[model samples]
Target: MSGLGMFGGTTIKYRNPTYTRDHGSLTLTWTDEWKTLGGCDLQEPTTGTDTKNREGTLSQYTLYMPSGSPVADNAQVRVDGQELQVDGMVLRIPDPLGILPYCKATLKAWKG
Candidate 1:
């Protein structure tokens, strides 16, 4: 967390879905307690085209956590009290130089 000092103050909530069988019907439920991660850097929103061929805002975020952070692709993101969907690919930035030991996850999302 030494190099991540520049990306402090903001906290991002990562939500994961859970499924259960309710009377022979599969029910999906989201966890009430989200995994809160600190030291996240959220970049400014940029305009982009979505899969539906419609114009929308694209936001990129970087999370500073351990190497095996639970946050995964298509995971729900809640920031600034707004729920947002994780779109496209979730990339993991590797430290090839062995300089920074902290794990960084980069995610791009389409803003609704």
Candidate 2:
């Protein structure tokens, strides 16, 4: 809830996650360790030297899962330490888990 102090509430097209008394909070986290943002080519180089930040917008962002998760909408994404709702498409994580600045300079792969 920290988008310039303007949190984009969950979209109406998608409903909030249903919780139960037996279960506390269904805190779901994105596990897209694929090291790739769907298509954002911000992977670091294999030089094994410099690990600077990439100068580009993340082409695609993915939400992580621990199991065979079904496609769901309005899923809450937690970047870095901030928790935010992934509304319809347009994502603006003001407080990203910071960016993988080194991702563009280092040679690695995400298998999440």
Candidate 3:
């Protein structure tokens, strides 16, 4: 736990993915099992110039989940009614004593 009380600032929604084969095709359809995850902190989104096209910008927010959170790497997140995808790996942060481990991931959306 962050002694600064950074967690529990806002609510988050996550959808664990379940894939199903399409009939006999090689394609797989992704299905979502939406669940609500509370006691987490969603920081304000920061904008930066789009590296690919420079014409628009990209927005990213850091999400801090509580220890033993059920949020998964393949899960999609919804914050403040905006759908954001996980930009990278979900990292576990632990204190020097290896206790009170928490998870952090970057949620990103492109506005171009």
* Candidate that scores best on lDDT: 3
Residues 1-99 of candidate 2 have per-residue lDDT tens digits of: 222222222212212343345456564444433121221222222343322364332223433221112224444433343333543333333225642
Local accuracy of candidate 3 as per-residue lDDT tens digits, 1-112: 6654346768888875555567765542335556888779877666543555676567788899987777766568988888887775688787678655788988877776
Model 1, which residues run further than 4 Å from truth?
A: 1-7, 18-29, 48-66, 101-112
Listed in order, each prediction's TM-score against the native is 0.57, 0.21, 0.72
Instruction: Output the better candidate (1/2) by lDDT.
Output: 1
lDDT of each: 0.61, 0.30, 0.73
What candidate 2 gets wrong by more than 4 Å, as runs, is 1-60, 64-67, 89-112
Q: Quick one: how many clashes does candidate 2 have? A: 14
Instruction: For model 1, name the residue pairs that clash.
Output: none
Worst 10-residue stretch by lDDT in candidate 2? 100-109
For TM-score, candidate 1 versus 3, the one ahead is: 3
Q: Ranking under TM-score, best-scoring first? A: 3, 1, 2
